[model samples]
Target chain A: MMTADERGEIEELLPWHAAGTLDRREAQRVEAALAEDAELARRYQLVREELVHTTHLNETLGAPSVRALEALFAKIDAEPQRRPGTAPGIAMRIGEFFASLSPRALAWSACAAALAILLQAAVIGSILIKEKAPGSYETASVPTSPGTEGTDVLMRFQPQATVSDINRFLETNKLSIARGPSAGGIYRVHVSGAKLSKDEATRVLNTLQQNRIVGFVAITH
Target chain B: MQTNSDEVLIGRIAKGDRLAMQVLYGRHHVQVYRFVLRMVRNETTAEDLISDVFLDVWRQAGKFEGRAAVSTWLLSIARFKALSALRRKPEEELDEDAVGAIEDHADDPEVALAKKDKGAALRTCLSKLSVEHREIVDLVYYHEKSVEEVAKIVGIPEATVKTRMFYARKKLSELLKEQGIDRGWP
Candidate 1:
């Protein structure tokens, strides 16, 4: 007694139902229809036969090249981290990278940190001293190199911004450079303060976008 | 015993763990490579895209929203990249190998289902299915994807997926019929 339109709809769902892809509710409905309908049951059997044929056919594809894995590993090593548009596993890497550092490396890192603090203090003092001479500031990016260890984000240089403008911008934000000014003029910048929360990263991107010396900033790690 | 799930591996991959990436690549690379090879009909391009697909996984593992299984997500990414690669190639360039792969089947209707080689006959008829039909069948049967998953991966509506499946099923049955193997249903 099922209407033709109703049967057609059920028929359309039959293959998927047989293939076991339907949601539980829909599968149950198909089961209910099939129990009462001989034609529907036959269609389901045909779908099953087709499925069997296709599955067997796909098995004939041979395995891929043996060199595929080696080539993939090489390419991964060669390419710098391109901050994905999605969330990156950066937080975990930061922890692991630091944990694996040797004691000597840790001591060297501490000394380097001290030197950086001193240099930053001096830089800030210079900006204060030159408060009256704003245009005389040095042009330095936040993270000054392309592939600095521990640095993962990227920021492109704005077309017309002067060095002094970039320096002033960094000074105002209290951000430090990790590395860059690659041939293409992109800088690898460190997130100022602690690890960047999602909201904080978005805010930083928005802030950079508004700054005249920054263009196309992104978290690439 | 419980195995480390793909989600857990992706979590580690997001953190820049190369080992995690290698583990994931080992788990899914072959299926992905096979899928790509089937589509492009070129081993070199298929191999190259396998790297590209896994590289995207390594780079974008953090973006996975868990809306679909990791395997499904990987296949979707593979499908997109394969289609893009296909579009970039000249149409005439696909002429020989891809076309020949399908038409090379024996034309003799008498031998279509010669009971001694039904499996081979089915495979030949399968190769003859249009790319669209072949993909639908592959998604449903070989990949074991649900209609919704197939719809998501193929970028078609659920209804369209069913319709495509119906036609693909019909076409496959028709091809089998031509080869003397009608299964008495459709």
Candidate 2:
């Protein structure tokens, strides 16, 4: 059995260590204690298990409604006090330009040497397609950011679709609009804050395609 | 990789980058909403306050001096709004709502009554904890905030964070024992 003082010290640090919030020095101390004491080790495991249960409980809470998010975006758009774009904005835009490619487009252009040729061809193709239809791009790049690039899924909705309808469709498929309404009405969407596995992304893409209101669904890179 | 860091996002947000705002909102809005939801126990109210919190972030992005993680900053804003809303309403109404909201409705009534799932039992017990204790547990376990971050967000000393969490865990352990799921911690 551990001494009263030793138990107290271990108890104090166990929660932090299990929470993965203990600083480096303190974490090392806890590790040393756990290595030497079976009781302390058992306590640490209990804390870890409890933390997992607590996390699951919290995960059950419902997210804010779609109407709430749309309102937030509309309010943001109406706000007139936007500051001028800076160097970071420019950088982010450049990053977005690359991230917005459809998976098919990425596949066609994955080879670095052929990237320039493929992109030039795709741009020409999009322009010709746009000339044929105002809101249609046979080959267009959607807008996406760094985190969303690899998981980018390209989707489009009926231009006349209601925000409520669109939001419902997106929410149903667990997709979020990352960037879009580009010249061709293409949108770069992702699996909404998740790094979905290839199978999962494919599943999301398939589910989205089943939605009648969603015109086209394709997983870009 | 570093470009998407919270500080960078805040920097872009300070420059009124709407895209940056969207990114940040997507990243943290759910957690902030959940935090606020637990406090006030009203979904609509929580949703409204979440928007309010982000609007505050949009307006005050420039004021963020990197003293705290973006999550910590957001929770601080959320907690403030939740408390203010609670103060405006009658406490008894909130207490009733909170109790109702925390119960998991998806479980079978018979099973829940006889013996709750560990998660449901824990949540039911957590709902009984004082608002102070609940938030502390939420911050550490769900939000994954460091003790220091919890202290900074809650405006308590680090030592106090540990003490509160200790007591909160003890309370939880007792509740779990009462439910026949004891792990032997005192």
Candidate 3:
């Protein structure tokens, strides 16, 4: 009968020996046993072979097709951008949903602007020739700066101008403008007036063919 | 096809060459991915973590001391990331859909998809080994680090390293035999 320590040592040696984990001394001892004993070497080979074959099977299972990797990458790209403790907000979700919205809205807006410019030219002709004012109107705009969105503009009706009048006011003063959000909210004008002199503000003020209290200056011109 | 060596690729990536990054990613992503998947067992999480690994490489390639093989350093990064990901959200679910996607990838496009599969087989087999024995085989055979290096990595005697190697290969061979895989190369 083997002593407890000897039995434990052999047992400890078995897995490593079978798998070839033993260092030279331990390996030599195991090998010497194998040299004197066929059974030990056979057992070692058996264990090693099983490990090899099983690993091979795993390799087969883990093999993914190229289409699969691309699909995986594409899937990763499509995963929702989420943070650790919070769900994504609605506004962003909406933008993501509408990410592919066509330039149709922009084109239509441009057409409307061009038409208004034409109509405004006609109105200006009438006013210049007839020397008379038309009915009441109001003016406002939505913004489209390539930066973080600011407070949304709500529709405001000034008693002195139409969309054409606002457009004219902006054009004459070199101020950009927003008509309105098609979804919701009012039209507003955007004037990049940082460092704008009081003289420049006064020029824009006088050029206002429509009504709007110029809000805060966003950046210094 | 012949590819640039890992060190050269790493140097280029460190220098902020986007093309070099693309090449390096192409070469190592799958291997690193396989290693991560094995450690974490969650394919989607594993996939996500590998990106962090690559990003670190891109950011820190300049800091690499050239002390270890690119593979070893990469595996080390992967190991750290997988552990942290697991620690942060111990319950992070393996996205079944993402895993399915990975399965599909392993099946089709990656020309080396076959190699990753083989690596998976090796990983599963390695998992069956004791942790001590596992590291040795992983560092030497799969990651292909040398014995002296492996000894230094595991902080054990060289003799202990050889003994562990003897047993690791022996057991691996036996396991392969039982599974009807060829145990020894012909």
| Candidate 2 chain B: worst-modelled 10 consecutive residues by lDDT | B102-111
What is the iRMSD of the candidate numbered 2? Answer: 4.2
lDDT scores for all predictions? Answer: 0.76, 0.77, 0.54
CAPRI grade, predicted model 3: incorrect
For model 1 chain A, the run of ten residues with the poorest summed lDDT: A143-152
Query: Candidate 2's residue-wise lDDT over B48-97, tens digit each?
Result: 99988998888888767766777889999999899899889875666565
By the TM-score metric, which is better: model 2 or model 3?
A: 2
**Best of the two (1, 3) by DockQ:** 1
lDDT of 2 by residue, A1-221 (tens): 45676567568768778878877867876888888888778888878877887787778897888776787877777777665643333444555566788887777666765878889999999877778786654444643335643477787885435588888876766667877877678988876465678888888778778765677878776
Q: Rank the candidates by TM-score, best first.
A: 1, 2, 3
Candidate 3 residue-wise lDDT, A16-99, digit = tens: 555454566666665666675555556555455545654453354363235434543454346454233332234333443455
Please list the residue runs of candidate 2 whose C-alpha ends up more than 4 Å from where it truly belongs after superposition: A1-3, A74-221, B1-4, B95-97, B100-116
Judged by DockQ cut-offs, the docking class of candidate 2 is acceptable
Error of 2 at A58 (Å): 1.5
Q: Name the regions of candidate 1 deviating beyond 4 angstroms.
A: A81-221, B1-4, B91-97, B101-118, B183-186
B1-186 per-residue lDDT for model 1 (tens digits) = 113378778877876778988988888888898788778888889999999999888777877766788888999999999889988989777855586555444656535345357666666666777778877778877787887789889999867888898887777777777666767756
Model 1 global lDDT (CA atoms, 0 to 1): 0.76
DockQ winner between candidates 2 and 3: 2
